[model samples]
Target: MTLDYRWLHDTVRDRFDSDDAMEAFLPRPLTPDELKQQGDDRYLSAMSQRVFRAGMKHSVVDAKWPAFEEAFWGFDPEKLVLLSPEQIDGYMNNDRIIRHRTKLQTIPRNAQFILDIRQEQGTSFGEFIANWPSADIIGLWNLLSKRGARLGGRSAAGFLRLVGKDTFLLTSDVVARLMAAGVIDQTPASQRDRQRVQDAFNALQRVSARPLCQLSAMISLSINPRGGLKFQTQRY
Candidate 1:
């Protein structure tokens, strides 16, 4: 049976030492203007970091980010978009960075993708992320998967969370809550399942008057009490 968001939030609150502790644990949602103010290079860098972190040890990727910044020219989207064929080839043997060729190639391609968006929408990539409706976040995930390299499944959602875009990540804890609430019968794999998840979150957001980020955290805390599965919390 579906529970009211108040019940969910209280359940999470109960697990904490105090109300202040709960508040400190949850992330603050970014406003549209705040999101827009983030530089393009920061967005590109975050995207690339997420790409590299997938299926790899996050600490390892993070430890090498400085080399990545130096090698990739501080993740400047314009500069990356202008990368020469020779420069792309050189990274394969570069000892300074992770030499995974496929992931390496996505950097410039994603840079071009960012530039394309600016050209088409006349807004920065960060603004584009901020302007997307939270109610249709699954649709935003689909768009990112199609338009941005290496941003499918949870990666797109993770990227949104990383940038403080006020969206939810469909992590296992959230999925479990969704299933328990009768939102879905199984893991959300099909388009219909994804839509159901989105609708469920939209309903919760309306009922709770909470941003998707806090709602996601609430669901997670409700599941594991001590906190959900451990993962890297470092922001790009």
Candidate 2:
């Protein structure tokens, strides 16, 4: 007998509506186990990014961000300013972090801009963070495109979503999960994998209207391989 694709799709969609349903459908969260299997360094980095992003989203002022700020010298535009041209040349030889000469140079300027925006808005740093705009797919695409950000549109969207912006509907690992679940046929997987994931997610919206993050996480966990979902671990 031919499998009813529509029924299969609907079943998958229904299961993704609730974590309880998802857990009932699958024994455990799909991706975490796989990630744990990867090894300490990889797992730790991935967990760190996830935790950092979550803190950023919830406006947890005293979390990983404090450490990040302290390490980067307050991320103050003036205080942790970008490296000078001479300093940039020296950074090329330093082995501290990935040395993107241009980005390193832009860091101070970006910090300054962030500071200016904070001051102009007349908000405390914590408030500014709490009220920061959700980096939805379209907004992030526009923002990154204007700045010539390294990643493509979908990749940027995924990164922003991973960082706690709930605006985007889907992410790369989520898309992989969907494909695994047989909810959607695989097409040319590209940097825009997040968009594909979002498309499937939006299709489900027609059935059960709900928050995007809740839906995305449910769908992702459902379809994720035995290995955990792959999230972008590094910021720089």
Candidate 3:
């Protein structure tokens, strides 16, 4: 009972008035070289931003990113990994940034995680991100959760999406469409359920020759019909 890829593409195209308009909305995954060129600072910043954005308004976090950049010393992986507990605790009192101590604590820990990747891979964290196969992106999400602090589930997927990695997001709308297509009985949390969802996306990607990001977006359009993502209150 998988949704037809052609049908999903057609439905999404029909939503827009013209072909060009629809084309503009389609997401394209970055190439390995392009992704690798982003450097560690950018990857660190993107990861930190996505972490802070969890369970909070994106615009509010985005508006304060400049202060974040300054406070975190431009998110340099080498610099952030050395951040002391006293410095991290000071952020709790800093009014310019989000004051959630738990979330604030993740920055240096995750920064060290990024540095570990560089030490092991002999390349920037961006290269590590770029090398992950899109077809098995769920595995990467699992790795992130296991290796990096506060990088499980939505945070991992959201970070990948933010960095233009070719991965599908399991947003509520996408999960609803998966249920309707008989891909899953409920929101995928367990490894078995998440693997099923990944397999479904892989099948669709094979049929359409599109990245998972595009397939995910098209599926959302097919189900929701109306455009724009409405944030759900619950963490998925």
Query: Best-fitting candidate, measured by lDDT?
Result: 3
Candidate achieving higher lDDT, 2 or 3: 3
Residue 214 lDDT, candidate 1, scale 0-100: 80
Q: TM-score for each prediction? A: 0.92, 0.47, 0.93
TM-score of predicted model 3?
0.93
Off by over 4 Å in 1: 227-236
Q: Write model 1 residue lDDT over 131-155, tens digit each, in one string.
A: 9888888888898899999999788
Distance (Å) between predicted and true CA of 46, model 3?
Answer: 1.1
Worst 10 residues of 2 by lDDT: 39-48
- Per-residue lDDT tens digits for candidate 3, residues 1-236, read 57788877888888888888766776777888999999889888988899889888888998999999998889888888888889878888899988888888888898899989999999889889999898899999999899988988788898888888888888888999899989899999999999999999888978878888878877877777653534222221
The segments of candidate 2 whose C-alpha lies over 4 angstroms from its true place after superposition are 1-71, 119-137, 147-155, 169-210, 221-236
Query: Model 3 clash tally?
Result: 0
Least well predicted 10-residue stretch by lDDT in candidate 1: 227-236
